[model samples]
Target: MVVERDELLDESCRGAAPLPQEADRVRLDLPRRDDLPDIMYLANNHRIAANLATMPHPFSLEDAKALVQKAEAAHGNSAFFAIRLRTTGRFIGVARYANVEEGMPVHVGYWLGEPFWGQGFATEAVHALVDHAFTHGTMDELTAACRVTNPASRRVLVKSGFQYRDQSMIRSLGAGGSVPIERYNLERAIWKSLRTWGRVAS
Candidate 1:
């Protein structure tokens, strides 16, 4: 389930940190051109698009191509991963983190296909991404937001060590208007403490 060679993103990741981060049941790696059809199929649903701020409903193959293209051109300041099953190599969703400029707080975001909801995959993928951010980068904290109506996403953030910050509004292309969202933040110090506590408990 790994790319033998990823020229698109490899240069950006070299000497910085590792890619294809692994979780208990999933792997996070750069999306490929081959993933276009699957991405188009899974992302075209209204349910998935409504929860995300930028994704539009009726996501077509061209949109999927654009997504992979965007990932290829990210240039290491950001990382976009295609969440896939380790065993089956099935494209299930997407996850990413980015900052508007250096030294600013990076924002993490993710979305799973509708059929994959309620399976805990989202939490696992998020944990993998969070660990990568705090472990390999200098950011002191990461931020996230979910549509107010999306309890599942909110729970995923909580379960991954993010604390509720405040409420905000963002335009959702799928929803066709502005939507209320609940913001959350996870400090690197808190994340480290949680990891230590988990180790002690285990």
Candidate 2:
């Protein structure tokens, strides 16, 4: 049975009390107007923007606002979440299973502040999204990609049970040029099997 988009998240995503959904270290919440400064501060780095496909360098408050608007307009066909630390409630980055291709929707993407890098936040957030997508939502597969040069992100995708799919050149609006990326895919069955093996061990 295909679950409707609105029902993609509910009590099942949390528990009997229906608290905000969180993984081991962070919770995936909606981006808020109050988060503008945090988004601007974290997303303005050249290092961070270079790794992402669409994040523009020197990100501004206006960019964050436009993003917030886009998120608000999406009708739940995708899950766009602001990745926040579970303990501190600090906004570290963003993660989601949106921006899917028209023919096949359900692609995953994420980013974290440079300070939050190397702490496994990206992997943790991704694992949570993958689990939620299979449990509370309906999707057969999820796709992801990273610039071939971005080892850190590629590692996260592999750790999240995604397999190498292909390599292609895609234009990066932020980069103002085309970049090559290694494509990856994670089938729900593969993700589930990994869970059984504790491959997704936190």
Candidate 3:
């Protein structure tokens, strides 16, 4: 699916890049302080946190605030978007392409509220984020991982054109320990080909 820019979130930079972009049914924008309550409500679940690396369980308002602050601080080095329903404009989750360090490959990640699961929203949101990263940023490839147990997430990555790369272990603040993960990667050439062939899965 070709992701489209519905409207520029930062109008002042009209021709530069689209700060907020849209997919078929979801919108992606920077997290805001006002979104804290929605973020906390959707992100506090042990179920959601267990599958993620750094999200703490019992996700609090302060954590939500920090998340927004961090997104604000990222400038252009990283992209953190609050996923929202397009028709209703309700915050549902978050998607990000983050820099692990100064020179490491960027990694993509996302999470949706429990109520929004099993609806293809995650996949659509990921499509939009991947498009933004390749279209606007300079990264040649994007990396991702999911818990060994997270089949749904694994499916999302595959649908977004990420190929399985390897296995690794990472500490999960929510899981309270290290866990096994399956890594995946998507190269710019692959993405460009997918776009040219119109094969990006919706």
Better of 1 and 3 by TM-score: 3
Native-referenced Cα lDDT, model 2: 0.71
Q: Point to the candidate with the largest lDDT.
A: 3
Better of 2 and 3 by TM-score: 3
lDDT of 2 by residue, 1-202 (tens): 0001222222222221112568889988777898899999998987776666667777988888865654553333366677899999888887766534456857777788888888988888888877766775667888888888888887788888989989988666555788788888889889879988997544
RMSD of each: 5.6, 6.3, 6.0
RMSD (Cα, Å) of candidate 2?
A: 6.3
TM per candidate comes to 0.88, 0.85, 0.88
Model 3, 31-75: lDDT tens digits are 778888899999899988878777878888888886776565444
What is the full ranking by TM-score, best candidate first?
3, 1, 2
Residue 179 of model 3 has an lDDT of 84
| Structure candidate 3, residue pairs in collision | none
The lDDT of each candidate is 0.77, 0.71, 0.77
For model 1, residues 86-116, the per-residue Cα lDDT tens digits are 9998999888777745566777888887788
Off by over 4 Å in 3: 1-17
Clashes of each: 0, 0, 0
Using TM-score as the measure, the top candidate is: 3
